[model samples]
Target: MPPRSAPTARQRRLGAELRKLRDSVGLSSTEAALRLKITQSRLSAIEGGRYGVSAERVRAFARLYDCRDAALVDALAGMTAPRRRNWWEEYRELLPAGLLDLAELEHHARTIRTAQVTHLPGLLQTVDYARTIFRQTIPELPPPMVEYRTSHRIKRQQVFWAHPPKPYSATIHEAALRMRFGGRQITREQLAHIVTMSERDHVTVRVIPFEAGSFPGAGQTVLYAEGTVPQLDTVQLDTEHGSEQLHSNAQLDKYRTFLDRFEAIALTPSASRGFINQILKAL
Candidate 1:
């Protein structure tokens, strides 16, 4: 098969893990390719996520690299399964690849944790609230584009409702809940929706009140997706330019610590709901 021109984040991550395995063993790409009886280009294509890899091949690579972590190897092998068409595919052309990648990441995550100060987590955002936020895009988005984004975001929320849904924990700052993006009515509805969603058995919503000032990761919005194994976990940051996916050990470690701190400073779920109710009542 021809090499993929644009590999999805999951695909890239699988390849990256394979590369890390080889690097840890101190083997150059050429040497590894020789051991695997493949051409240098073939190895590079696999490492670059341009070519498909079989689960069997992944296991073989793991053994060749002398990796002892069975859980990580199993996680890597599981990622090699054949791809299926997903809801995000329809927006392949209309929306940014990063958006689609995020949907896929959430779909596969064992658990999802997010922290936001300026905006609510995408998965928890309402249609009107999201559309209103989109309207503020610097260059401005067309009406149709805004609708597309809003619908896509709503669709992404399916993960929360799926059978045996993944556990979701969101830590939101009081500032985000107070921001009235679309006006009082919309903001009121959005906050109410959050309270309702937080009532679900599997959903957890915590709030960092104004009293909890100067917290770590106060300015950035982060989504930390826990994969089947910790080694496959990822941290996504919303940046001015676009979504940035980070999986390096150091990056993941830093974000893990940041998330822990956020949770530590956040109000309990019940208290958070009451806090939001207070904000809603004030509005």
Candidate 2:
């Protein structure tokens, strides 16, 4: 099959995991390719995520690498299945590739955790609140483009509505809840929506009040997407240019600690709901 011109982050991640397995066994790319009975170029393409890999091939590679973690092997093999048409595909030509990758990541995540400082989590933002934020884009998006993104952001909330809904936790700062993105009315609606969503059985919203004061990751917005296996967890950070995905063991560990720290100071679910309602009432 012809190589993909631009593989999604998921595709790249699968390749990276395979590469990790090979490296862990101390096999050079050339030696590994020779053992697999494929050309070095073919192995290169697969490792670069430019070529497709089948589930059988993934299992074969795991065996060749002498990997003993059956669960990790199974999870890696699972990622090699045929790609299905997902709702995010419609925006493939319109939005930044990172945005689509993010939706894809959330779609497959076993659990989703987010840390937001100045803005409410995208999945919890109301339509008007999302549209209002989009309008303030640096270059200033065209009206239609703004609408597209707003709708896309709203559509991403589907994860919360799915059967066996995905578990979602948000660690939000008091500043975010009070941002007033679309002025008072929109902010009020957004906070109310957050309260309502947090009440879901699978959703958790914890607020870090101003009294918490001077914490780590104060200005950062992060999303931690848990995979079927711990080895596959991914951390995504919002940057000025685009989304940055990190999955190295160290990176994963660091962000996990960050989330833990955030949660350490955050209000309990009941108290958070009351905090949000307090802000809503003041508005």
TM-score of each: 0.98, 0.98
Clashes of each: 0, 0
Those runs of model 1 whose alpha carbons end farther than 4 Å from true positions after fitting are none
Q: After superposition, how far is residue 187 of candidate 2 from its true place, in Å?
A: 0.9
User: Residue 127: error of model 1 in Å?
Assistant: 0.8
* Model 1 TM-score (2 dp): 0.98
Instruction: List CA RMSD, all candidates.
Output: 0.8, 0.8
Model 1 lDDT per residue over 1-283, tens place: 6788989999999999999999999999999999999999999999989998999999999999999999999999999988888999999999999999999999999999999998998998888999999999978999999999999999999998888988999999999998999999999999999999999999999999999878896589999999999989999988989988999999999999999999999999999999999999999
